[model samples]
Target: MKKILTAGAFMTAFFASSAALAACETDVKKDDITAEQATELYECIKEKMREGYGSADAPFSKEYQAWKVTATAPAAPGAHGKRFLITYANETAHGEYVKFSEERADNPMPVGSILAKESFGVTKKGAVKAGPLFVMEKVAKGSADEFGNWVYSAVQPKGKVMKIKQGFCHGCHAAFEDQDALGYPVEEVRLKP
Candidate 1:
């Protein structure tokens, strides 16, 4: 029984180490990584990301992937700490959100629409780093008047609800007055309307 227990422990450690080593990593600078390469990396890490987020027991984390993907590949932009971000739009948000419209004053995102963005970063030492899952949900008119009627929240990489300051997120998003505070993905990866 002792030998069997030892073998089981060894097997568990081996698999854990294998999983750790299997993480996606690249020496190439983030800016220089091509869409194909980014997609490849995404494929390698996406499942782990989903599992991590889903561990939070949040509806969005588990359901976002079933929604429409807004970009072909993750994009690294100045926003979101320059991490690579791939966005998803729920059914309520997809039709109007996909328009990537710049006419928000008159055509705002419908109430109930939700957007989820998954992020990841690469370190200077070439290690792939998982990031939080950002979420924005549109509430009924006047519900969250201070934040353009949208609520911003996040889930940590380990599935904890991240503490988010509404004002901080809104401060930057407010710059996009024409897009209803929506910051679309960079053009290179944006899916065609």
Candidate 2:
């Protein structure tokens, strides 16, 4: 009788732990976009990039929101996958902004050369042969700077199997040092909004 009771308890515990793990693997959905709109959201980013450099007058304000896209993985081993984050400003500003970030299993900051050649298949001459898809997770809130703006945070991709990429920081800074060059300033980009 005691052996039967112990076995029952162990089974219950095992099932409970398995259930928790399964819950952690949540599937990201496409409906998270505000306005349930796509084209209008993408246009917002196009306008901001054209404006050149981020400023108070920038078309997009520092608000928290998320956009979604469909993306693909690379074929070669050790090649980091790419994704795009499309974000929008809330009440503080308007328009959309598009940014590219990546995820890898081993090296976090892979060289741009490897990224261009292996992952993107882009030639050193700056020709893009293939493009990948990505989805925005959502802007994080409660973080702010001295200006009292709502800071934004985004996940590179959406879905259950996504892993955070590494080359995002190095790649963007190297390519667009003037505009998407700088990351959110640490003093202004924390969880203390």
Q: lDDT per residue, candidate 1, 1-193, as tens digits?
A: 4555588898999997776566477768888988887876787788898889989866588889789899999988879998899999999999888788898898899999999999988889877778999999999988999999999989999899988899999999999989999999998998997
**What's the TM-score of each model vs. the native?**
0.87, 0.22
Per-candidate clash tally: 0, 8
lDDT of 1: 0.88
The 0-to-1 C-alpha lDDT of every candidate, in the order given, reads: 0.88, 0.26
Candidate 1, residue 55: the lDDT equals 92
Model 2, span 1-193: residue lDDT tens: 4555588898998998776444322232223322222222333333333222222231122112222211121122222333122222222122112123222122122111011111122223322222222222222333222211122222211112224343443444334333322222122111222
Pairs with steric clashes in candidate 2: 44-96, 45-96, 71-133, 102-165, 103-165, 142-193, 143-193, 144-193
Model 2 segments more than 4 A misplaced: 1-5, 30-171, 175-181, 185-190
Give the distance in Å from residue 60's predicted Cα in candidate 1 to where it truly belongs: 1.2
